[model samples]
Structures are given as structure tokens and as C-alpha cells.
Target chain A: MIGYLDFVIALALAGAMAVMLTRLCLGPSLYDRILAVNSFGTKTVLFLSVFAIMVGRADGVDIALLYALINFIATIAILKFFRYRSLDVALSQMTKRIDQVEGGQ
Target chain B: MANLDLTQYLDYALIAMLVVVGIAIIRMKNLFAIVMLTGTYSLLSAAWFVSLDAVDVAFTEAAVGAGISTVLMLGAMLLTARDCKPEGKARHIVALLVVVITGAALLYALGDMPIYGDPNSPVNAYVGMDYVAMTPNDINVPNIVTAVLASYRGFDTLGETFVVFTAGLGVALLLGLGGRKEEEN
Candidate 1:
């Protein structure tokens, strides 16, 4: 009985992923694409969890957890890189420099 | 059909999603969109791996593909143009022909391989079987994959770790540990 439920849930997630991919492909802006990518990662995490249940294994949840962590970090890194144009800069330092400039002006 | 397993439908859907993402990645010229689509491609592949019951491989794919590679590519993109230059018309035909031929060859080759999860397949029948049996008795690791990777294949894992360390060192050397020096007055 639970297996059927898992299957149904997995199928719905897959359908949502298909829609997300469509949005990703049709995006008129980079932000739209980024949003799509992040949402897709979330769906993947959920799908992995449901799939682990469907397959009657506990191993997949470990992977799903790792993916959830990495996906969030990657999205942040992408946004940060685009915003600052560099990865190594400290965010606080950048904000401080901005404040200094505003004070000087 | 009543006999059809619903999970198999999910498999087909995932496969279809993968193909569509791949085509989109190819057709798009914007580097940002392409990078994002690549992540989508990686996530889809990881999910597919889960469906195939290869959790270890799926984990690696999710980490390396969806995470590390996406960030690395974005970093690399910062040094390059935002959009790809238009290719000459002649090159497209040649590229398409090569792709079609290679794809056809791969499809033909696929028929020769054993079906997925076939117990009688050579990979599952030989050393894999030994590891499965030995893992419980010798290592007492409930997860045979962990045992085989850490114990049975210790040297391979060590080598992979070394490769990753070297890559990290190279990147640090090239890019520096700290942010690029603030522009001089």
C-alpha cells in the first residue's frame, strides 16, 4: 500500500521537474534560470527520499541529505560570484568598503 | 496495463527530462543559462541514478555534478565572455553529423550489454558476489558499498583523494587563497 503512494509521489515530483526544466529552458533572464535550477535541486532531494522508500532502502536518504546541503551551497556561491564578481572576497569587507565610500561621499 | 509498475513510469519521465535538458543546453548560447541548465542536467542524472539503485554513484554524481562542477564552471565563466560566439554555418553540419553517428553507434552498442540489475551479468556474478558475501563476514559492514570502497578498494579511494587534493592545490595556486587584491589607487 505504501509502495503505491511512494510511486505516486515520485511521479508527481517528476512531473514538477519537467515543468521546472521547461521554465529553465525558456527563461528570458539569468535569475529565472537560477531560480529554476535551485527549485529543481529541491525536487531532486524530495524525489530521492521517496525513491528510497519505494526501493525499500535507507541508503538513498544519506545521498539526499548530502545533495540538499551541496545544492544550497552551490546556489549561494553562484549568486555571490555573480554579485561580487569574485568568490574569495569577504562579504563583510565588501559591505564595509561600501559604507566607507558612502561616508566619504 | 494492470501489470505495469508505476515506478517504471517515473523512470521514463526522468529519462525524457534528461534528454530535453541536454538539448536545451546545446541550443542555448547564454553562458549563465547554460551553466544553470548543466546543474539541472546533473540533478536529473543523480535522480536517475537513484532510480537505478546505485546510491553510492548517485551520491557522487550529486556532489560532483550538481555542486562542485556547477560552482567551478561559474567561477571559470567569470573569466570568459557572457555569450558564445556564433559558429560558422559549415561547422554546424559537421558537428551534427558527428553527433548523429556517435549517438547511433552508442544506441547500437547498448543492445549488446546485459539488462540492468541482471544477477547473472558478469559484473554481479564474479568479484561483486565475493565482496557481497565477504563484506558481512570479514568487515561486518552492513553497507557492502562502504566496505568495498573503504576496505576492498582502499588504494583506489586513496588515489581518488590524492587527485582531488592535487586539483584543490592547483586551483588555490592559480586563483590565490584570498580575494584578488583591491584595485590600487
Candidate 2:
């Protein structure tokens, strides 16, 4: 009863996952891409858990939990690293170009 | 017969919510709105699982997908920009093709699956009996889901944990010591 219904729900959500993938591929900004990927991760967790029931295996639940943790931690870390090494920071950095422009120009 | 009962009504409701959330994730221009759609997607999925009598699976999905994943996405958003750049920017044919191919292959394979809840199905014959038959001495856990996950399939769960550890290590390496703005003090 509920099993078939769950299958329908999982299927519909998978459709959403497809849309998120579009954003990940066609994102206009880095943050958009990050958000899309995070959305994808959340869906993956649900997909795995539903799969556990579809197959009657409890192991899938454990795997979903592991995946969810990984997705969250990775998103934050990547964003932080980007900020630390942003292109603006690179342009502002002291270099030979600064000396040459300051001295010659 | 049983599926056509109240369960179908519930199923229709869940499917409606799922479709709505799916559209929200894609159509929303706001980054937070998209992230939030993902959260609702998780909760709806958890509810779906619960309806299916897989409460343990529902619990995990609710906790991890609805809980931790949202926080991480928010943190990631904070670390960088918020609003997405203007739309209509990048090429995406390859990814679409891949997703389509994969979905098609899976659906084709699933067509051969045994009937739902068939009594003579191998899953019911070879597998389902153990949970009912072996609770007393073979595994001590009252909850069959816990027993199967922790003992019967213990090694597989450990492998999953290993993957989480690996990801955590990777995040630690990537972020270093950077914190939010004004935290430099």
C-alpha cells in the first residue's frame, strides 16, 4: 500500500533532482551551482533511503546518513575556500606588477 | 485492492507535494528558495518512507537529509555569494543526455521486477523470513531494522561510515581556518 505510494513520491522527487541538475549545469553564478549541488545531495539521501525499503535492506539507511553528512560538510568547505582565494584577493595581492606600475606609471 | 484504499489517497497527496517541491527547486530564482525546496523534498520523502513501514529509513532521511544537509547548504551560501547571476548562461546538453540515458536504463530494467508484495517472491522467500524467525538468540535487537543494519549487514554500514569520514577529511583539507566576516577578530 504505502510502498507503491512511496515509489511514486520517490519518482516525483527524482524528477526534481533532474531540475536541480539543470541548475548545477546552467548556473549563472558559483553560489547557484553550490546550491544546486546541495539540493542534489539532499535528494540523493532520500533516494537511498527509499531504495532501502524497495529492497528491504536496512543497510541503505546507514549509507544515506553517511552521504548526507558528506554533502553538508563539503559544500561549506568549498565555499569557504573560494572566498579565501577569491580572484579579487589575487588582484589585490602585492606582486611585481604592482611595483612596475607604481614605479613606471 | 488494498493499495486502492486510503493509502492511494495518501500516495496522491505525497506525489502532489513532491511534484510541487520539484518545480520549486528548479523554478525558484532565489538560491535560498531552491535550498529550501530541497529540504521539503527530504521531509516529503521521509514521510513517504514512513507510510511504507520503513520507519528506520524514514528516520535517517529526516535527520540527515532534512536536518544536516540544509545547514551545510546555508553555510556554503554564507561563505560565498547569495543571489545567482542572471539566467540563460551555460551549456548543459551532455548532463541532460546522461541523466536521460540512466533513467531510461533503470526504468527498462525495473519493468522486469516481481509483482509488488508477491508472497512467493525471492525477497519474501529468501529474505523476509529471517527478520521474523531469528530475533530471539541470533540477534538481540528488538527492532528488526536495527538488527539487520547493525549485525546482519554490519560491514556494509561500516563502509558507509568510512565514506563519511573520508568526506569530512576532504572538507577539513579544503576549508582550512576561514570563518565568516567579522569573525577575524
Candidate 3:
């Protein structure tokens, strides 16, 4: 049955999450931790989608979509902040580059 | 074992994971690793919320907890030390005692709550039933959580939106990201 399949999927996802949790907790380097967190976010999105189907709520997909977008943006923001030490600096540099390109065009 | 359902097993597993992650976060010395574990904790808790059929709460947790909060914490960490300073043993003991007492109090309080997802629970008996029944006719939305959040509780949702906006504005102002100034020569 469909319910059984959903249960199996949920179990598998939970197992993967457990592995990611170990990596997150035991990371010797910052980038390793970041990669683990990123992978966990992707797994969470899939888990949410499976759960929505299991619960017979098609609209749960909306939440999953929101998570997908926010997760991507957050990862980028974190990486930029880590590299530049200031989001403001990153933003201004990006804008200045864009303006230069536009002016050249 | 025969009576236990899939959801029950899943809930137990997720709760166990959450507890382990919480402990790891507390014991971590590296601030960056702690932040990463916190994000994982949030994701696990969000999954637990979904299992409880609280999609709206799960959505908010996923977005705010795992998403925005992680990024903000990383930014803050970048601005500060990557490793946490060692604390005195006395301080550690005091903190542990405080945590234990607070956790014990919370566990005691949990005894007064109704069983999860019980149809006969007071919350489900009153406003929840009405929302479920009226949502189709009142809002015509397929998702009751959406209808309740956006329509039935429009003013509350608006307030939440404004709170988020204000937080963003505060961060932007604090970071001086508003207007571009010439780099110091």
C-alpha cells in the first residue's frame, strides 16, 4: 500500500539524518560541519514532502517549497558572511560589480 | 509492538535524535559546529512537528529555525570568536543545575497535557473543529493551516509579517547595509 511506502521512505530518511547528525556533531573542520548541515536541509525537504503525502495534505508541498528556497538562500548568506566577515561588504561589492558590468554594456 | 503504529515509532525515533543533538550542541566547543548542530536540531524538530500534524508550526520552524536563524548565527559567529571560551567548573556546575531544574519543571508540566492528536482533546473540540468545518465554506482553501494562518487569523499573521520585517530592518541598519559609502582610502 501507499502508506507502507511512505513509512519506508520516512524510515530511510530518518536513518540518513542520523548519519548526518553524527557528522555534524563530530566535524573537525568548519566546512565539514557546513556541508553536513546543508545535506541535512536537503533531507529535511524530502522528508517534508513525504510526510505531506502520508498525511494526505497536498498543500504541504507549499511548505516544502518554501524550505527549499530559504535553505538555499541561508546557505549562500552564511558562506558569503564567512568569506567576507560582513554581509554589507559582500552586498556592496556585488552591486558595484553589477553596476560596472551594466555601464560597460 | 502490535498496537504501535508507524507514526508512533517515527515520533520516538525523531525525539531520540533531537535529544542527542541537543546534548551535542551543549557539549560542543567549536561555535561553528554548535551552530551546524543547532540547524540539524531544528530540522529534526520540524520533522517532529510534521508528524504531529502541525504543518504551519513545522513550516515556521523550518524557515526561522533552520534557515534564517542559522544564517544569522553564522554571521554573528563570523563577527566573533569561532571557539567558545572555557568556563570555570563552578559556573559549569551552576549552569547544569539550572538546566536540570528547568527541564524537570517542564517535564512535570507535560503531565497535564492531553494526548497528542486526540479528537476529544479540548483544543480539537472547540476552535479546531470549527476551523476544519468552516474552512471550506468560509475560505475555500484546501489547506486548513493556510486558511487559518492567512484568513481566519489575518491580523495576527500581519503582525507576524511586520515583526519579521522589523527584524530584517534592524539587522540591515545595524550592519549599515542601507546606503553604499565609499571604501576608506
Q: Residue B159 deviation, candidate 2, in Å?
A: 4.8
Higher-ranked by DockQ: 2 or 3 = 3
Clashing pairs in 3: none
Best by lDDT: 1
Question: Whose DockQ is greatest here?
Answer: 1
Q: After superposition, how far is residue A13 of candidate 3 from its true place, in Å?
A: 1.7
For residues A1-105, could you state the per-residue lDDT of candidate 3 as single tens digits? 348788789889988988988888887767777788888888888877887777677756877787787677667766665555555653555433322111100
Model 3 off-target regions past 4 Å? A91-105, B1-4, B136-140, B166-181
Give the alpha carbon lDDT tens digit for every residue of B1-185 in model 1: 32136667887999999999888888988888888888888888888888777776777677677877777888888798878999899999999899999999999999999986799999989999899888888999888888988899999978767655654553453334565567632
DockQ by candidate, in order: 0.48, 0.07, 0.38
Tens-digit lDDT string for candidate 2 (A1-105): 356766666666667766776665457666676677688778777876775665456766776776676566546544433444321122223121321111100
Ranking by lDDT, best first? 1, 3, 2
Which structure among the candidates has the greatest TM-score? 1
Alpha-carbon RMSD of each model: 4.7, 11.1, 6.0
A1-105 in candidate 1: lDDT tens per residue? 447777888889888888888899997777777788889889888998988888778888988898798788678777666656666655435553321211100
TM-score for each predicted model, relative to the true structure:
0.85, 0.54, 0.83
Docking class of 3: acceptable
